[model samples]
Target: MRTLILALSALALAGSAAFADPIADRQAIMKANGKAVGAIAPMVKGEKPFDAAVVLDALKTLSEDAQKIDVAALFPEGTDKGDTEASPKIWEDMAGFQAKVEKFRADTAAAVAAAPADLDALKVEFGKVAANCGGCHETFRIKKS
Candidate 1:
């Protein structure tokens, strides 16, 4: 009974530890966002045939991933020092950081609503949505060596 109790306690601790790492969780969310962008970028660039369904799917993925970013919870203080590329400016000006996140969400939502079915429309909407990525990264991401 003692051994069983100790094993169960260890399992609980391990589970909590996995969920407690906000840095890892945020990184995963960002990676997913990047992948969604990749999926539609070629279509916008004319490298791949424009597929309305693919564009909508990618836009939805971006919208969902953007919504997952609970800024305060994911970027809580003390998470700054790790394998993270988040800028210190994020903590110093959380409001700005959150605004950028909101902009990204709004842009993604707009892209979805536009439902770009042609290369021309995809270019326009995708440009708006992708700009949020560059703008946010400029202000809220550290340049890695």
Candidate 2:
């Protein structure tokens, strides 16, 4: 039984490590951030009726995702290949890239703090968060498609 348990644990760890791709990890994180924005954007745009709870949840998601992002570590050496959308300039201009990432984190946190109670307020707060995302994408990300 002990040997079996040890073997299972080793297999699990190895399986996870085998799928650990930094570029994919970062992309997944960014996709999560996008999903959060998508969830609330319609309400902010007045296309869908505002729901305070949903807005709060979306903001929370953004904040959580921002906190999880480690831009520097995610873009390690030789991670620029494969399906990565990250620009090579990210390594060359690391300071600028990190600054943009920090701005996105700050903006997401500010959006959470703003805690818009209505659509109008939510629009304003969401705009700030969106701008931060756009800034980072424009500077550091390349659209492969």
Candidate 3:
């Protein structure tokens, strides 16, 4: 009985993780973006002396995440369930959503390639990356109070 219970518990845990909701997965990805931004923001603001390596890591993370987030797969029917802040309009206007995603991907890639030499240079490239995030949030993301 004890062995059976342990086996069942392990299976349940594995199943839950294996089938983790896409909404949660995407939310985690966005959270990672925020973390990367947080790491770079201080240096960009001149609070911390600019570290080229840190900046590159942040930009690389942003670029990778932007490319990996598959909207079509993650936002499938009813993925808007639970605590997700995804707007219904994402499905309604997928073309626009995809455009925004592509823009972000391009902006991040450009920023990565430019490899800003200093805080001032990083600011301009970062602004474009930030704008892409803001533009999508303004239209496709629902604000949660």
Candidate 4:
């Protein structure tokens, strides 16, 4: 089941580039999100501790990788396709979109930097960091459930 999820997630990220322009940047961000989530799935499922150490380490790697994705570059004119659900508002509201992405990066960094030694406490804090994801997606990206 885990393998299936990972494979499907990878396919989604991998296939995302084929959907539109600025392929490199969108692909990078999706790939980074995939990698970050992959590293944390065990913890999320309770197979592992809500380990701050693990979360911190994963975010550290993810944060650096995420820097490669340029929000502006990824949404240039003519990038959209039939399959692309990215809202037209992304281009129209460029500044707002960029702010969300930047906040995600900063919040992830903050979560990692402040990761607690206690695992349970870590879980609570980590949730805040993870929420940054939906924060951006809610306004900018189109994803079904």
The residue-by-residue lDDT of candidate 4 on 17-66, one tens digit each, is: 56655755576677777787677767866887676666778777766755
TM-score, candidate number 2: 0.85
What TM-score does candidate 4 get on C-alpha atoms? 0.68
Candidate that scores best on TM-score: 1
Each prediction's TM-score against the native? Answer: 0.86, 0.85, 0.84, 0.68
Alpha-carbon runs more than 4 Å astray in model 4: 1-21, 50-53, 82-85
By descending TM-score, how would the candidates be arranged? 1, 2, 3, 4
Candidate 2 vs 4: which has more TM-score: 2
Candidate 1, clashing residue pairs? none
In model 2, the Cα lDDT at residue 131 comes to 89
lDDT per residue for candidate 2 within 32-95, as digits (tens), equals 8888888898887778899989989988998888887787568888898889888998998988
Model 1: ten consecutive residues of lowest lDDT = 42-51
lDDT of each: 0.91, 0.86, 0.90, 0.70
Scanning candidate 4 in windows of ten residues, the lowest lDDT window is 78-87
Question: Is candidate 2 or 3 superior in lDDT?
Answer: 3
Per residue, candidate 1 scores C-alpha lDDT tens digits across 1-145 of: 9999999999999998768889989999999998989999887676899888888999999999989999988999989898999999999999999999999889888889998878899899999988999998998899899
